[model samples]
Target: MPTSKDLCNKEACDIQSCLKKNGFIPERCRKVIEALERCCEKCSYNSKHCGSMSRLLGRKDEL
Candidate 1:
């Protein structure tokens, strides 16, 4: 079975695209944001790229 980190690798770009289309409005992309948060939390301590998702996004509560 694929892990959260694996899923994250596949869907990370969705967030980027959504942000670009919505003028970086996170509230407008709640679903995508939540999905990425789940992945980031799963990979927090294990994946270097995902370790700082909360810090990088400035929404620590979500992660």
Candidate 2:
């Protein structure tokens, strides 16, 4: 089974592809962003990289 960090990494990549496929319109990828947020919550058990990414995105919820 995949660890929380692994799942988060996968979700991060998914978000990247979703961004590219949706022309980087954040509004066009709400589901993907939520999914990544869920994954990041799980990732707290293993890593904080997701926190940095969330900060980079300027998402208030993540901070």
Candidate 3:
């Protein structure tokens, strides 16, 4: 049986591409990150692509 694709992969890749184009200044990628966050929220944070979201959102302290 095949597994279903994880959610938010495109959003995550968009964030990476945005950050690269913006000299790794995450602030410039805020919108893409927010998009991924919204997708992750919809999936209840179960996506593998969401594994780094806490750190990306600067909420690692809560982890």
Cα lDDT tens digits, model 3, 1-63, are 312246787888898899899998777777787888888888888878888665785642232
Top lDDT model: 3
**Local accuracy of candidate 2 as per-residue lDDT tens digits, 23-54:** 98676767777777776665553644476467
- Those runs of model 2 whose alpha carbons end farther than 4 Å from true positions after fitting are 1-7, 45-49, 56-63
Candidates, ranked, lDDT: 3, 2, 1
Q: Please provide the root mean square deviation of candidate 3 (C-alpha atoms, Å).
A: 4.2
Residue 12 CA error for candidate 2 (Å)? 0.5
TM-score of 3: 0.78
Best by TM-score: 3
Compose the digit string of candidate 1's lDDT tens values, residues 18-39: 8799997767777776777677
Model 2: clashing residue pairs? none
The lDDT of each candidate is 0.62, 0.65, 0.74
Question: How many backbone clashes are present in model 2?
Answer: 0
**Candidate 2 CA-lDDT value:** 0.65
